[model samples]
Target: MSERITHRLVEVPGGRIHVAEQGAGPLVLLVHGFPESWYSWRRQLPALAAAGFRAAAIDVRGYGRSSRPPRVADYRLLAHVADNVAVVRALGESTAVVVGHDWGSPIAAATALIRPDLFRAVGLLSVPYAPRGPHRPTDGFAAMGGDEEFYVSYFQAPGRAEAEIEPDVRGWLAGFYASLSADTMGESAGESVSFVPRGGRLRDRFPKGVLPSWLTEADLEVYAGEFERTGLTGALNRYRNVDRDWEDLAAWDGATITQPALFAGGSLDPSTTWMAGAIEAFPRTLPNLTAAHILDDCGHWIQQERADEVNRLLTDWLRSLG
Candidate 1:
């Protein structure tokens, strides 16, 4: 199944983007989130392909083989949306159905929201859609952490996280992934991975030893190798731009995605719980929502943790879009 997938670099504005694609039919562009690459969609590529759709996943700039711009501002949401648009154009297609997981969820939603003509429909996993609002993102994050610093706030300083991650990318990645998975997350129940104590590192709360059921040693190696080569700066930069994204997207404040859409989140995922209000307001935000689901006992890594179910829901939704 893996052999059927092909990889290539498509030229975008700042640099070339690496893309892995499979199958053939209506284009379904898959975008990854923080600390991950195109490989995160390894399962979906083959599944979507076999199900009769062209599935293409990309290293969302700053990860994998994609070009990582030197400046932090380069990783803003608008740039990511532009990259998605360019990738679709470079593929020789005028439009595509975009699906995103984790941070990719926002990127995909922004793409669909900003360019409805190009992205006909969208599927968001792990993260729900919430349009820009009154508060600055950093201010909101700061308030969320209370005494402890939110992980997003911890990533603001340029070299802070890189110093922690670069030393042992593979080991760090193992703990990070485990901390977010349903199986091993209980090890750090009192110490949330999402928040960093005043002087402590985020990895301090991450579980050690066991890998999540969905992640194998090889899977860990793929993610670690990419970050090891590229470093965490590019990926972390996405966090640094939240305020900028909020400011840049203000024109669309309180906007709704009018296009057909689908959302699937893990019951155990903190993102779902934290943004439950957004999900409840789907009727107002995603007026054309096709389906919304919360997979039982799942965690942050939605598509990866529950591949079969997610694949079924995605394919059904994609087919419904016809």
Candidate 2:
């Protein structure tokens, strides 16, 4: 499976984007989220390929082999959308269907929203599409964290999260990943991974010594190694730009994604619970939604945790677009 996938760096506006691709049909571009690289889509590439689609997953700028710009604003939402547009053109395709998970979800949505001519369809996993609203994002996040700091707020101060994650990248990643997995996350709702206690690190609440069934030691190492080599500033920069994204996307406020779309979320995932309103508003925000699903007993890593189901849903939706 690994041998079938090929890798390359496609030049975009600011830098080069590293992409891993497979198969030989219409293009399906995959975008990954925070603390993850193109490797996160390892399962989907082959599945989509075998399903008769050319699948390409990319390291969003500032992660893996993709060029990381120095400024914090470099990772804003529009910048990411441009990278996606470039990747599609660089691959010599006029259009594609974009799919994303975690942070990738929003990026994918924005791409389809901003460039509908280039992206014919969109798929969101883990996070649902919510059109830009009236309030500033930072204000909302600040209010969400009454006493404890919201994890996104905690990531605002440059070098703060890096300090905590750089020293032990592997362990931090392991705990972070485990904390979100349905098998190892804390049982109570108060123990959600979205917040960090005042003066305490986000990983402080992470479970130790337990790895999710979907994540092997090798997988953990792959994730850790990338951050270890590049450091976390570029990746963390994405969180810092929430307010910027909110401002940049203002023109599109309340805009509906009219493209064909699909959404799947983990029943147990906090993202699903937290963004329920967005999911409920899909009819208005995602008018062309083909199907929406909540995979029971699943967690944040939806694709990896439930590969077969996600692949079926994705391939089915892709076919339905025709």
Candidate 3:
């Protein structure tokens, strides 16, 4: 929100991307996840800028002010990875410290893996990037649990999720955000479900209530307004490309992230519980992993949930990269 942080649309390889930037130094690119935009890094933009890094956050393709390609195929990992690398070059940098959360984590990982020349260092939050397995991700996912309306499964069918979530974007956003917070997810951090039964609605998964403290009314408005304009098609398309992404990443099946890396997540984040093994074995998966921090009493929104702590950890990690 400060004048120091400026927004602009810059052209990438395939399309134009909207970026928010501050300060000037080593480039630190922030990539947000599902249902979020570049604004998601509001707190970190200034914090990292003050720490002497040119902090930049982009509205990942199909999200905020970025170009939204019509085909679902365009949202694949290869495309997202290319977009990040192109953005770095377009911003006049040969390399950057790529940081991501949730869906963005995998995208960042893919970038570092496929084009390490562009992403010198990597930081992953909330999600861990396990290398591609022998089986297709969709095949493994489809065989998971029975009689359950897996959120990803629900998102597989184009227009279905959009229909359910677009009508009342605010309500959908509120429920989705609340369900992932520490409050609705339980105080004691543990494994939890992120989906509902078949034919179930997303709102039904959470208690009818107000927005969580981490998400303010203004924050909600920003997300809602963006989704209202862009619709859920582009964002959900990311989920739809699971199999394609898995297949596309076949080249890096057993590869490890060979970059200086850092990871931080909220203790209460379901991803922490769900991907505990990967997080624990990060050093093995990412040979150059420098540090992994788990914020106490925090949830999925690690950066927003605990901005000060995240800023400190991120800055310290960035300092180490130099």
Estimate the Cα RMSD of every predicted model relative to the unseen true structure: 1.3, 1.4, 1.9
Candidate no. 3 TM-score: 0.96
Per-residue lDDT of candidate 1, residues 2-26 (tens digit): 3499999999997989999999899
TM-score of each: 0.98, 0.98, 0.96
How many clashing residue pairs are found in candidate 2? 0
Off by over 4 Å in 3: 1-3, 184-193
Candidate 2 clashing pairs, residues 3+ apart or interchain = none
lDDT of 3 by residue, 1-322 (tens): 3448898898877699999999899999999998788988999999998888999999999998999999999999999998998888889997899999989999999999999877899999999868888887777667664767557777898999888888899888877777677755542223324665676765665646667777889999999999999898989999999999888888788789999998888887878877898887777789999988888788898887788889999999999988
Candidate 3 or 2, higher TM-score: 2
Worst 10 residues of 3 by lDDT: 184-193
**Please, what are the lDDT tens digits per residue for candidate 2 over residues 24-105?**
8899999999889999999889999998899999999999999999999999999999999999999999999999999999
TM-score result, candidate 2? 0.98
| By lDDT: ranked, best first | 2, 1, 3
